[model samples]
Target: MTTTHISPEFTALLQSCGLKHVAIIMDGNRRWAKQKLLPGLVGHKKGVDALRTLVRFGSDHGLQALTVFAFSTENWQRSTEEVGYLMRLFVEALSLELAELHRNNVQIRFIGELSGLPEDLRKLIQSAHTTTATNTGLNLQIATNYGGRQEITQAMQALGNDIAAGKLKPEDITEALIQSKLYTQDLPDLDLLIRTGGESRLSNYLLWQSAYAEFYVTETLWPDFSPAAFEKAVQSFAQRERRYGQ
Candidate 1:
């Protein structure tokens, strides 16, 4: 099958933002699989392929950081088997692609609750992060078991506890301080947020980080999420005028 190739026009549209940070809420793997009469795991695997391609493309396309919402905190509500399969899939994907990502100068970072994952998978994620930390090309951040509310809550709790313990003063709790407390502390603020599967809501993805992000959503499920579709999103984003609450 031919993966959609990037067109000049799409690349031109992408120039509009200088797209320092782009986040994707990858959705609908199961639904896409259902449409194709394949098991959901197959769709997840295809999504991983798309992710690999996109990361390389982002590196070539000058995007500073690409944050992908892989699994939500609420995803734990899924069947145990499905969740287990996704964990295994993540391990397998990293196993197969780590060398290439490292070779291509991509920095892999995972943001989210690591404590909920299996010890082995957690180690795998940590190892990948450590291995790719020195690369300077694409910054690929995968949000696994992530929730916007949970992130904010955790940040707040940490700060509050710091104050209670006399490590911080309440007056020192600035927006930057809060930001530094979140999972994306070192990452750029979101410039664009793309959601697949036609979902309009944030679905608790990145609440604070996306306060000013330009939103682009589509009906394309993750398995069918093509480069062409991604280009379309960038085109749409390029045409927008950002006011930043002016």
Candidate 2:
């Protein structure tokens, strides 16, 4: 696709610095599939392969946390068939890949409204979480049925509950306090956020954690986003001087 490429030296520079917590808004699976005259489900399936590649790339590059937006709460508006296929694909991936992921020392975590998932999928997620709970390698956070605003709302609700129960005082609330109540409490704040499929928007992903994150948008589709493209994103992140409003 004649996209921009980053050199190996730049990739090394990216690995050496403060790119610990990286998140991706994976977009353009269906569009890629449509261009190739393939079914939408086929595109989604290919997106899974892209995810696997990114996970391994993250681990190899010594990333502490890698979060990917897999499905949004708004995805329910999609066709029933597509949604069903996605749910089934989620189940199948967990069933087939969890053991391998565990063996690789990847700690898998699903962040979002998991209660809305089918019971079997929920059980699989729970089992995967339990199985990989102690893995000390890459922190893999998958956002299924997740939204940035929804996460903030949920965190606020938890914070309010604590305050009402006399466990916390409203006056004591801080940014750190709100963070502690979040789904990503254990993870570090986002350092770099990438959006594939030529999209520039955050699309309601990681609103709270990406306050000062460097963003790299690419024209590459999610399914076609190779390790080279990933390095390019990191390269872009490495070049930026983050002042954080200093």
Candidate 3:
């Protein structure tokens, strides 16, 4: 597996493109832990740390928004104990990071269903979103219990309901309207998507919004995905000449 690297030419290109947004699938945490003989929860913990580091990277690089696939709706199939640990970890993250996030002007938003989450967790997420809503810094989005299919389905259902209520016409349903209904309604579409862990598949991520995104895959795993590694992904993205099916 070839490791990615940054070059001056690539840096010029990324600067030219003006990095607006970046989305990532924080993959390979479980594999990282299994290789180290560490508990699965330890991997998740490190994954969070990686996320924090990447968030700061995005900030320093002038990116406006970042989205991460933190937990998928399908992830519920994991053992209950692990799932429970993740929920508690999430709460801890909120408690510890919300202030720092606010201090940095990073607005937080959680995509996907929150109704099924623990009442306290749901409250914590809501408070974070509300408190940071006015921030103009990086719009950090975390997808928890999120599935692209479900996101699309829910957006369609919302449109259908609006149409049935004499609020919209079939012809009024434009691409922009549908996009506005997505979890990332106000966020820019993904410009680059980085997935680590050697997984070539999307594994149920942001399919609709990433139609034209540049993909950079690696086997480094999330825990070891350092800032230099992330910069390398950006460098790869900058080297690409996107034609968008032209």
Candidate 4:
């Protein structure tokens, strides 16, 4: 989709409503490349660019946090070659852009089962996290090999283990206690959840944190989801009345 110029009125409206935490389910990379008659990897690379743009935009707009669904646990079922290429691309992107990201004061974090990743890649992610931990800018969280069910299950297991060890009791399992054990404990609950590529399903994203989030689904594919598309989502969010089960 072609990007339109952002208007001052639109920006003011978004700011007025206050979008503190925004999450995105980025979809349609391979499909985008197929439609363009380009390699699938090319679409993935472009998706990375789109992420960079959104991250920068969020930071500039005074957003506190931005979480993106990157590689999901289900994505492992894809072809080995594509998965390998994605891993390599992830490492390359981190190496190439981490310094600029740090300079921009973005705190980089990865949330998922990272133990299954390559040692080199894991080390790089750790290094990036450590290097940017002190940044005061946008809290950038990337969900790689992440699943909502797995996160909740892990939290439950941790709570159970604590109870077994006598460090806690079964009665102590409150909603806050469960949230404290989740990967997103440090961030606020999701304020807005945007999905690209025309898909409307949550697809096992931040299911727990998004209990009251405003959802914006766009037909624009991930690679083609421009800043204007993001602006449009913000506009839609600004117009919503979040009753939060009231």
Ranking by lDDT: 4, 2, 1, 3
For candidate 1, report its TM-score: 0.93
Instruction: Name the weakest run of 10 consecutive residues (lDDT summed) in model 1.
Output: 1-10
- Tens-digit lDDT string for candidate 4 (55-125): 77766666789999999999999999999999998899899879988988899999999998888889999
Candidate 3 residue-wise lDDT, 48-139, digit = tens: 88888777666555568899998899999999999999999999988888988888788999988888788889999999989999999889
**Count of clashing residue pairs in every prediction:** 0, 0, 0, 0
* Residue 231 CA displacement from its true place in model 4, Å: 0.8
lDDT of 4 at 246: 98
Q: Which lDDT value does model 2 have at 245? A: 66
Give a tens-digit lDDT track for model 1, residues 180-241: 89988988789999999998999998899899999998998987786767778887877789
Candidate with maximal lDDT? 4
lDDT of each: 0.86, 0.88, 0.85, 0.89
Pairs in steric clash, model 1: none
Model 1 residue 215 lDDT?
A: 98
Residue 68, model 2, lDDT: 92
Task: Evaluate residue 151 in candidate 2 and report its C-alpha lDDT on the 0 to 100 scale.
Answer: 98
